[model samples]
Target: MVTAAFPYRLYLVIAAEACAGRDLLAVAEAAVRGGVDLVQLREKQVDEPTFLARAERLAERLSCYSVPLLINDNLRVARRVGAAGLHVGNHDLPPTQVRAQWPGVGLLGYSLEYTAQLHTPEAEAADYLGISPVFRTPTKTDTVTEWGLAGVRAIRAATPKPLVAIGNIHAGNAGPVLQAGADCLAVVSAICQAPDPERAAAVLRNQIDLYC
Candidate 1:
């Protein structure tokens, strides 16, 4: 039987600039209180030490709730801080190599930027596939093709791995995103930029639960 890696329904991707102009730790804590399943720290503008420091602090808080912390493109930091997992894009590190390098990092997530990757050995070994750019968004400048709802449906039909639909996902259209067959809905600006992080998280979680 295949084991699920990303078992959470609400995936929150937070960046320092995106956290409602507030402390990311505070925003994440409130988001957890509102029911975030997992959290990924995707800082685009920070040095190694700064990133490591932030990860350590966030790991401490998220651990209390038993929520997994995933580092974006940084396996060293994740392991250094005793993070639960790491999220890697296709361009970062090959999943096969990562698996060989760190066999113990339990939750391995692979970003699916194109349809051709669905059947690769990497996808087969991955615990979850992040279907990104489900809609056009400003959060990521290096985005792949806009997956749209149709793309989600196509990828869902093509893969057995747990799907984490990302990019521009919000409470407004979260139901459809889930219905399109994503096991989890990952958002950046939606909750991170909300006026009230807890409420934003709650609303998104509600949508996920409702659709399920």
Candidate 2:
């Protein structure tokens, strides 16, 4: 929970698979240089050893910028590396379990699509909520109904936790999401797949500030 106290800045998380063998540090550095508030290491297909190693490196690199580094799914690696937080999906580990394992590390995030999930006790325990697939997104392996700005607005109105609009949110549509009340934006291809990630991040940050 490195930046837990200052969560207003746009949370830019880059989800890169370890299998792709991409240079995560370079990508992360560019993002941070462009005012990204947070970075999450999301490597789903990799083995434990490889995932831990990469997460460790990312955590170290982010330390310089005081950028919060989060881990997806693995609480052990998160706890070991002192990650800023952890992001858990519907099928992944529960937020309560993560809190129990690492009580000192209070920042834990959860994924939500349907508004009903936000009413649950577990959702209340999480630090933030990542409401996704505002448009059709290939990144979501699960079935995602397009929860447009209206849906995102509903989530923002319903939850006290800060909202992070994810999946298909980019420079073009980011304004509406923030207007809908999103505190942050989580993007993958919008930044990672961009020709110039640094500039892409700045554009997204500008949009975020505009709407904020």
Candidate 3:
């Protein structure tokens, strides 16, 4: 059975482009050192071999700390590399399909941006929900739905499932996201593209803690 792996409030979504020429392992290590609990590798552009290699490296990096490494949009790679979980967007494989096909791979997360999409049977098949575009975020150009704080609050009240608020989230605005009932906050550029990913993560972690 799928279970929740998102116990930590500060979620880091890291992509190679966001690393700014730094090694992905280095970036992940720094972020973890600064208190990032869960990580999702969003490297959808690479070939299969490269993707598996990176996922393996990241999984090895986080093993000692016990931080789960989630592979984005590639359940095959996730299982091959022994990734802790999988995260899929709205356009990708629906959560129900993933669950039915895999049986018990790991924790499955689906993107939920609209209140209309809340608490659906597909959502129930997964372990957690990602409430994306919580604000206007350029970090993800493909995102069409921009769910503001009001939407986050609405989804929080509407769904019994665990909520992960993501998109353009930073240290300054994390409080309100948490106040709106987000169980965790997923950040991309806020921490991944910062000058010091470790320091950025620390500040963001403090912001999340302050809200609690």
Candidate 4:
């Protein structure tokens, strides 16, 4: 069995969505300035060449800030760009497989919503868990699970890994998520779509601190 690795660690991560129209690299830079500790690059429609280019640029930009840049669903790009990690879903390769392929590389996070999966042995090997749909969100239209504050707590109690609450999490709900035992909030539309991304990120950081 794949044993647990990364210790539980609290962190603020910025999730880049496919639906967001803005430039992700620029937004990532702004988020780092606003104290974001991690950034996930997730693009569904973009081709390999285009995705690689963008990921490379983003990696370069993030290098100076010491932020962990993780590619969602693409281990190749994560390897190529020298990213800090990769976040994969249930359908993707398991964290154990990822660790086998990239032996000494960085983290490998899994997306977990259900309590059962969160407590599974494979989940213990994950560097972190992205517990999603905290509130009603248009971003995850196909995903129906809405793991509210109660769900967040349930998942946290099941695993020692740091929990990152995503989907519909914004400035307003950030405090409650932390209070519910989430180590951080993974924001997508709230920061990527905001008129002032830096300001929005600042507000999220402030709220997390205030509630802590």
Per-model C-alpha lDDT, please?
0.86, 0.78, 0.84, 0.75
Comparing 3 and 4 on lDDT, the stronger one? 3
Give a tens-digit lDDT track for model 4, residues 5-119: 4332224344445326666777778777875767888776678888898889888888888777888888899999998889887778888788888886588788875677866
lDDT of 3 by residue, 92-190 (tens): 888888887778766788897556777577788878899888887877877778888888878877877888889889988999889988988899888
Q: Clashing residue pairs, candidate 4? A: none
Candidate 3: regions farther than 4 A off: 1-6
Candidate 4 differs from the real structure by a C-alpha RMSD in angstroms, to one decimal, of 3.8
* lDDT over C-alpha atoms for residue 33 of model 4: 80
Q: In lDDT terms, which candidate is top?
A: 1
Clashes of each: 0, 0, 0, 0
TM, every model: 0.95, 0.92, 0.94, 0.88
Q: Which of the two candidates, 3 or 4, achieves a greater TM-score against the reference?
A: 3
Q: What is the lDDT of residue 132 in candidate 1?
A: 77
Q: What is the overall TM-score of model 1 with all chains considered together?
A: 0.95
TM-score of 3: 0.94
Report model 2's TM-score to 2 decimal places.
0.92
Estimate candidate 3's alpha-carbon lDDT, on a 0 to 1 scale.
Answer: 0.84
